[model samples]
Target chain A: MTTSPQNSADSRLPLVIEKNLDRILDTWISELQVDGGRLLNLIRESELREQASRFLDLLRKAIKVAGVNPEKTAAYDELRDLLDELSRSRSEQGFTPTETATFVFSLKRPLFRELKEAHGDNDTTALLDDIWQATMLLDRLGLNTTEVFINTREAIIQRQQQDLLELSTPVVSLWNGILALPVIGTLDSERTQTVMESLLQKIVATGSDIAIIDITGVPAVDTLVAQHLLKTVTAARLMGAECIISGIRPQIAQTIVHLGVELGNVTTKGTLADAFALALKKKRQKVQDI
Target chain B: MYRIPILRVEEFLLVSIQTDLDDALAVKLQDDLTTAIATHHARGVIIDISGLEIVDSFIGRMLADISTMARIQDCHAIVVGMQPAVAITLVELGLSLSGVQTALHIDQGMRFLRRFLAGRDEEASDERE
Candidate 1:
């Protein structure tokens, strides 16, 4: 393990890459194919070759300007950008982090072969130093791809959470002056805020006098959930719309009693049908057999 | 001293707050509304806050006070047309205004007041019989 001076290793590294660009790419592609798992069938050979060649071209340019550690310098911005794009696209195509990183790491083997071929038996220390620098550079780039891949997955999760928040709290109009909000999940403070806001907004938009908050889809009844339900009911009532909490399954009713949640004044019923019947009666309308 | 207008519609005194009510204006409206309730022999008072974009705790307290005072004078106070945002703010501020009767619009407010007054009138007649 000879520690060659930084300047000599940095200067010689880019020359080795530039001299054997095509040979390095050919070997890198074959290396990727050998190790490729499900990802081999997912992406085509031509597109993969184009991406690998572009990455190598930018890498050589970045290394020439910013040495082996091109991460901090602006010269490697294009190289980093290409890696970011590759990571994001691969993530969207359902590629695992290991598969995405293999693309960058596979280049190391090909470059090592070319480096060995370029520096024959003479100058063995310089050859080892070059290999070390190339190893460091490829490792950094592979780690960068993994970082971007993980980030892309996190962003997708965050966006789906926002989408779920909007999709879940839908306030439907059941009658002329009635609205029904069917809650379907756990009532956290944030989700409760969303549920309350949407229900209140719909009440104002529809001028609904009576709102039935059917908790049939709600899996459990906790004190916090009860508080959120009460808050939604109170806000609706303050806006001049009375709320009736229906769909109290027997188990939920027992849970409510055990939790000692006071659903005070806000009417509750066994089923949506009974609540709808009461709402109709309040509106002076009746549903009978035709 | 800017005074909020109080329009008398039939047996109900209608107060539509069209502007943001500062402390003094809100107090003045509360004072004038109680006086108008007495002068017009109003059976009910409907305070419409649909035009109000913002309401602080002071204004919320004044609304509750007016409702309680109207009830004392045998006049029902129904706050009508409260904006959803204002209602949420009031609820968040821990002011439910539980004593004040509420309706979605002026029309609903009138209907509610009529039913309430009619029910009271029947009870009074029943007491006499």
Candidate 2:
């Protein structure tokens, strides 16, 4: 490997890439160290440097989308020099071409993003050697983590417009247009909006006098959850229906108070049975008033 | 900080708002909720703000639209869980609900809705006959 290192480096085409790789590694270390890692210490500890490299690559690449200005080039250059020095150390930490290639491959995404933002489609061809390897590895790894990230971001926006879409619950109208909607699962901003809208719409469509929301399936409740619940109850009332909140879990109950969120005088029941009783109590009181 | 909806009820959609309800997400919420309610005929919609640190103008506008739309569908809108900061911001910002009714808690709002439901029932029976 040592005998062919010079030839290998020379033959890799596009002299600038070797320089860039040299720059990226050398700069990343000294500048992006965590817990006060020194350049020399990082070089000595192969595992530590490897870990450091991974973290920096992940964050830098993602953040590169924000735009990598030339002003920060100094930091990258400094770190790359440190790594370059380590690569040439007397202890023989010389990276084979494949290893160097792997390091470059890991950086493919951030590079692509940065290049795209800077020069449009032009950057794609410049890093073909590196990008192709990364792409193949990415395909093989098939990480679905990005999907979750996408869904999460999308869900946030979806909450504002529709509180609810009525995708799961079945709304049935009774003799006096009573509607019972049982909600299960988690609620977020997007889902909260969906619930609010769905409830309001169902109230009008079914003309239901009462809507019971059974929360037996709710896993947890925080400030966001509490807010969504409050919105839902409020919306139900606007539609002219009595809203019943059932199933307050022990942990959730603790969290609500810990967070100091007022349920807005909303009736809370321990179980669905209790919720029905409360709804019935309202009916009885109405009869008495009449 | 993305908040996803797990359950939706009539006029009472349950969603946990999280992360920052940034410009892009706020727009999505407004449009999607508008579509869902328009199709479902939801009268009242509750917006839970437990997971959010703040509510921007975009969120405020979407709420207003949702309330107005609910009215067209014969449903009233009630904004719930307006954090004290949020309330102050909305008031200081000179933003008020024109077509929406708001309550501090869900229970108070529910009582008001019960009456609407009762009144509508009598009217609905009359219409059916």
> In candidate 2 chain A, what residue range of length 10 has the lowest lDDT sum?
A5-14
lDDT of each: 0.89, 0.54
The local lDDT score (0 to 100) that residue A225 gets in candidate 2 is 80
Write candidate 2's Cα lDDT for A136-174 as tens digits.
433322222233234444555576433444554445443
What's the distance in Å from true for residue B118, model 1?
4.2
TM-score of 2: 0.32
Best by TM-score: 1
Q: What is the C-alpha lDDT profile of model 1 across A51-99, one tens digit per residue? A: 9999999989888877887658898899999999999999999999999
For residue A118, model 2's alpha carbon misses the true position, in angstroms, by 42
The estimated TM-scores of all candidates read: 0.86, 0.32
lDDT, candidate 2, at A98: 32
Best by lDDT: 1
Give chain B TM-scores in order.
Answer: 0.97, 0.73
